[model samples]
Target chain A: MASNIPEKYKTLIKNNKRIDGRTLDELRPVKIKVGVIPSADGSAYIEIGNTKVLAAVHGPKEMFPRHMINEDRAVLNVRYAMLPFSTSERVRPGPSRRSNEISKVTRHALESVIFLEEYPGMGIDLTLDIIQADAGTRATAITAASVALAHAGIPMKGLVAATAIGKINDRLAVDLNGPEDNFGQTDMPIAMISTNKNITLLQMDGDFSKEEFKTALSMAKKAIEPLFEAQRAALQKYYK
Target chain B: MTLLYQNMQYIRNNIAKNREDGRTSEQFRDITIETGIIGRAEGSARVKIGDTEIIAGVKMEIGTPFPDSPGEGIIMVNSEFSALASPDFENGPPREDSIELSRVVDRGIRESKTVDVEKLCIEKGSKVWMVFVDITIVNHDGNLIDAAGIGAITALLTAQIPTINEDGTLNREEFVGSLPIKEIPVPITSGLINNTIITDMTKDETECSDAIFTVTTIENENYCAMQKAGPSEMTEKQMLDIANIAQKESKKIRSAIKATVKKHKI
Candidate 1:
């Protein structure tokens, strides 16, 4: 298939209209559920438009059997899984190259937000399972899982808020869904600490000119604030 | 020597009369599992049967079809037991025990036609989506079949299929909704120790028991699979006892799953 840029998209971007006809900077609706799993130490389920993710936090006890015991930090074990029915078609089971990379990157993103030093010689296992896949699984997982950890009463420095920004048809867009991601020229997933606005994780796949990447980066920074607020709101709702 | 053997026999008799956990022969340990633990997975869950902990995650991807099933998508289940969970697990490919666990769980889900694979086809006879379900045992207490089964069902229930536009594009914001879930099949596992049957056996009991049995409770009244994983043989009377216990306890397991889903308010 030829990559023909849609004329309507080109014109809409010039006029600042999104594919769904929203403003260039607008985000889709977000819903967050916390304490969703009674058995987990902390758990949350988050939905951003069609993308859905669940995060559960367990333990600050028992160092993993073989890792060198550190007296000052907790080991974070993170894994990301997507359902076969989470998308239009089915996906293969097991960690794909993409999911494995996402799991590592997400773990780093979260480590930046947690006070690992608070509990040395122990481990906290954080798992993010996607019940559905849309576009922003990594970002949604990071943001939602932080709320779950907080709900589990695990002491953390602050919440990690994340979002994806991309460029499609020469236009910058925030929170790209699956179609936009597949056809989009450049895609970037960004994670930031809500407390101090620190950029903890940044990953970009696909082609992007420097200018486009910079614009997308700025858009991602702005994109994370609402996500941070959403996490806070979810916690409030469940706590109240 | 005779006196020592007699003391051991007396201990066994006492346990047969009274369970170590203080529950009756038909009693079960507590169970709890939370769905959606892995962020990258489309549908995910972590299940706990006392101390036996299993986390299952489902992920979707678009890919070419296997030579045979071109029109329908696929659902594959993989099970891994981390060495941290037990020293018995090696660090390479999946061991036989893990494979058995995955196969049994997959059998219940696939045999029941829980997921409508026909609906998952994006472009028939050429390309289709593959649904991957990954189950990891973080803590191996006992009765993994039941824990994995619940995790798998919960993940599937919460799973959604994206809207595929006729224009050869996907409507990212248009949530087409969940796949066809014909029934919620749950597995109830019991341990048979010294001629006694107990429901939802814990890790300690399972390790100390002589045999383990799993009864997959499907629909409201049907059993899809009855699996026994131990060297000991069960008599007809003992089997009847286990079947009765499974029938009654399966309801509680199902209700827990339903309540958790409702509480998550998803």
Candidate 2:
């Protein structure tokens, strides 16, 4: 695999500890806040390590462009974007191929849990903006977006929590940082419903043996538990 | 609309037994592959899975490598969903569906290192051969991802590298050798309908499916790429079972591709 990481940072793990001093299967400090943007119907902010993302939900309102209206259910529109200043290099404004792909997959990740059938002839627009990024921006966006949907009072089967797991130096690790992501051998991002542990979104790149994939799946499941709790706590704190 | 509902109902009712096409829950539709169909391209193949048909063509060009991997060549996968393929498709820029399809297929080939990209380098950091696999969906039934994946790998396996002229220009007419291939990755897709996992779904079945998963595996029966799509959730156990099925099915498809390549004497 081609990587741009400096030669000095090639070593990601030492004595079962990552470069960031977290053990394998450990996550970075996560902080969640709900109802951050009062202008939006629902909104939330989340920070996972250095990555920060904001999600806002609008509608169950009238859908425009007559052709897109769904009579049987509400249409869900999700747009994911990384602000130009989100990364060290300025990402040009507007959708790039990578952001477009992430937007599509993020929509898939959240669509399964929302009850779009309740509001016929309506539309729900969810926007996720990455304010800062290190790695796992998609997962962070998803975790925040689910909370935003809940804060918007949308009916859902369950909250969705997501995380990325990968192999760094032949060791399975959870929640990769930027260097680990670029330098590692594999990275798999997964999302699941909090209530029933039903997987909603899964995508992987790089190589993985059968056993390694199985282990990584279990590790992702385990890592998502705290995210689910954080989402619940955020909602509860807001309601309280 | 009534007829469509009836067809969906019938499939759902008989999902546990045999599908409308007489395929069991884990069975795939008949697959046929034809190689070297396009005379203009370096390599090309047409693949059909049941009613779904797609043509994949490889065009090699001389290009500068990316700054990060200047010593290696580039492999790009692109898909075009022609409006003629299906009524739902429109003539416009590539939509999310086509983007996801191409990216997933790209992931399978790139992640598995199916093509030895390093060998295409001409002058290390300066120039290299860029392989472009362009997929055109001729017919839309279902399981386009798997079919496209097969078509891409098959076309790439048979592709010939263009030779360079004496003055540092590409000689499109002459072939130096075959493109280096290290592994064969096969993608298998399964649809979840009424809680039943079915492989190689038809158009109607895909329309009724609650969700779908595509898993790509290599020769060792280990997975290289996976994507779960649509608007439904799946349990971990169900996903694991689907992965197992993908592994088992990939072998059969890989062998089929090899036999076809051998028959064609590529």
Candidate 3:
């Protein structure tokens, strides 16, 4: 492995290639299945190529006392779990810093999309399980989980779509895979309301030059169109 | 609430020729197990039984080898009793009851030898992967053994080990799929209440039961471990009857697990 990001990223950029062999804007295959778990109020099984996420929604129930009960808005509790064997190496059990960060970001993203104010004093729990992982887990979870909530007939403002853009060798690429992610100089995951283009969650790891960041942001926004369509197509299959 | 008791009594009075929930005593609650949840962990699963839900994440790490078992990987099962599920659990270290729960769940999986521990060694006598199976009780309705066992086994079955290079580096493209376990272990708990052995006891039944009998197995026919809990002593006939229930019900649970594994093909 290259010790520094600049050297590795430069090699990929110079070769006109990505670590996963995709062009700068290509995405892995996205497959979404709705209502996999019969017990949950609503559930979805979404596979973004090798990265698999299962999102279940249970809610609009009375909130427990002692916890912060939102009388004017519903609470969203999202837990993101990646099975130890979801990757090539085993990970430590419990919430790591990365997982915790993603969980909070995912919660914020979905909370913005869901019409929580309509179900005041109740809470809706969203659980996202990553059975297989390659990259783009948080983005995949946010996308799938929103679709699940909408399918559950919980009032949702609009669909939220997310994708990551990163700087690899001074080049901007949308949707970084595991290898590119590790070696990339910067990664920015953006969650947006596809309908109104509202930004819900934004997280970036590593630094990007201002111009490079702007290019990546443009690439990420452009990448959302197809994903938004696909998410719509999935919910339509179940709801319509 | 009154209607609930009426239904319970209706089922109880007809116990001789009928069963609670309209099924035979030798029956299990509907079970659903899904794998590959939690992307950061190597393997993860969520197992549900009726209203009870448990999520288990198996994480692997390379650490200094234990002195006695330098070549073998260590399996550790940690449990979190969340007050979110029940008021009895306060936020702190695991209580004695939770500890006992963890021990019992760990014993079943460990004694079954589900994972090939020897293969987890990266450097013999220097470093080996410590597989941590963390089970979180999201809801505590009843029969966590089956839920935990299902989660643990499914997580193991879906596990993938990254290919390690000679210089102790992980080659990103190469993956060894799934832990090589000789057999998948299935556990089911049966409760004896009112001199009756019920398969897949509910929380209420468990709370009021005289004793509880739990049997763990690789399949319906092959046995790995058995646990008996509760207060009431069992007669010889009841033991035989309960064993028969375990033997019969084990097949159903085993089949469900196998079908799930086959469907997911992790």
Clashing pairs in 2: none
Considering the two chains of model 3, state its CAPRI-style docking category.
incorrect
Shift of residue B215 alpha carbon in model 2, Å: 0.6
Tens digit per residue, CA lDDT, model 3, B1-266 = 11355655554455556555566777777888887777777778889998889998887766877665677778888788888866556888765446545665776676566677887777889988788889999988878777887788787777777667888776534576667677666767787666677777766556656566665655525445544454334443454455566567667766777777677744
TM-score of 2: 0.97
Candidate 1 lDDT (Cα, 0 to 1): 0.71
* Residue-wise C-alpha lDDT for candidate 1, range A33-84, written one tens digit per residue: 9988888899999998789998998988787764546677888888888878
lDDT of 1 by residue, B8-87 (tens): 45545666676656877666667786865665556678888777788888777677776556778888887888888866
RMSD (CA, Å), each prediction = 22.2, 1.7, 21.9
lDDT sort, best first:
2, 3, 1
After superposition, the stretches of candidate 3 with alpha carbons farther than 4 Å from their true spots are: A1-240, B1-20, B163-174
lDDT of each: 0.71, 0.91, 0.72
Best-fitting candidate, scored by lDDT: 2
Query: Where's the lowest-lDDT run of ten residues in candidate 2 chain A?
Result: A1-10
- iRMSD per prediction, in order: 24.7, 1.5, 26.3
Give each prediction's DockQ, rounded to 2 decimals.
0.01, 0.75, 0.01
